[model samples]
Target: MSASRYQDLVAKVDAKAKEFHERYAAQLQCKKGCSSCCQPGLTVFSVERLAIREWLNERPDLIEKLKAQPGNPKACSFLDDEGACQIYPVRPIICRTQGLPLSFKVNERTERDVCPLNFEKDDVLALPTDGVLNLDLLNTLLVLVDQVEGGSEAGQRFALNVDEVTRT
Candidate 1:
């Protein structure tokens, strides 16, 4: 896909992410400068890799600094010296949903976890509403990526990993 198309997709995803954040902000007490999730050993998807590479290409010095960090396990290529995402604007959907009251099924049982900061709050409650998050927006972006590779999910995943892309 062209850079314009990628930009459009990123913009749409970012907008949807902001909307999601606003809708659930009261339930999530994730304050700024909380780098709990920035700890090493995180596995990022291909989309995140592509976005980070794009960010790095625009800032070679940042890339050099990231590579020069001592004892860096290279866990998350997106992390800079300050332990912040280099491409927060176009981060993946999972990153956007990191600290939310999300329900996921496992072994036919529903589970929930509040953000650490909100854990002690009693007034905060998980709304019974379903499908409030705009996950379809993320799916749509992935579909657009797949279409670029003749409708192959694997190809889209590969592109996100930056392994098959020349730009990375």
Candidate 2:
């Protein structure tokens, strides 16, 4: 995709993210330093892999820093030792939806997980009234990626080895 187009999508995604945060701020108490979701063994989609690789390619020094880090296996390539995304402005949809009350399909069944902090505090009651949590913005970004590279090809191709990329 063209850089201008990517920038537009990034802008929209960032706006949606800010709106999401505003809509959920009262119900979510997940402050900084909480890295519950930044665990090991998370498999990102090929598009995300590509985006991170592109980001790293532009910053060779950061790649070297990541390689030198200890015990950083299979985590999101964008995550730093401080447990924050290096490219927060362009983080993937899944990361963007971390604390929302959203639903997803698994084996033909819809399941939900209220953010642990929200669930524990009886904040689930407020989520329903917070308006629709549509993921269309994210889906649109993915579609754009697919258009740039054929969908099937993009889905199957993994550009970087997570372990090798993370090794110092």
What are the Cα lDDT values of the candidates?
Answer: 0.52, 0.57
Best by TM-score: 2
Give the number of the best model, judged by lDDT.
2
Q: Assess candidate 2 and give its TM-score to the true structure.
A: 0.69
Error of 1 at 7 (Å): 5.8
| TM-score per candidate, chains pooled | 0.62, 0.69
Q: Quote the lDDT for 2 in model 2.
A: 44
lDDT of 2 by residue, 1-168 (tens): 346444565566567657867776776655554556665655545556556566667778876776666655556555666677765655555666676665545686645566687547654434453343444445656667645643344554342344433323
Q: Please state the error at residue 58 of candidate 2 in Å.
A: 1.2
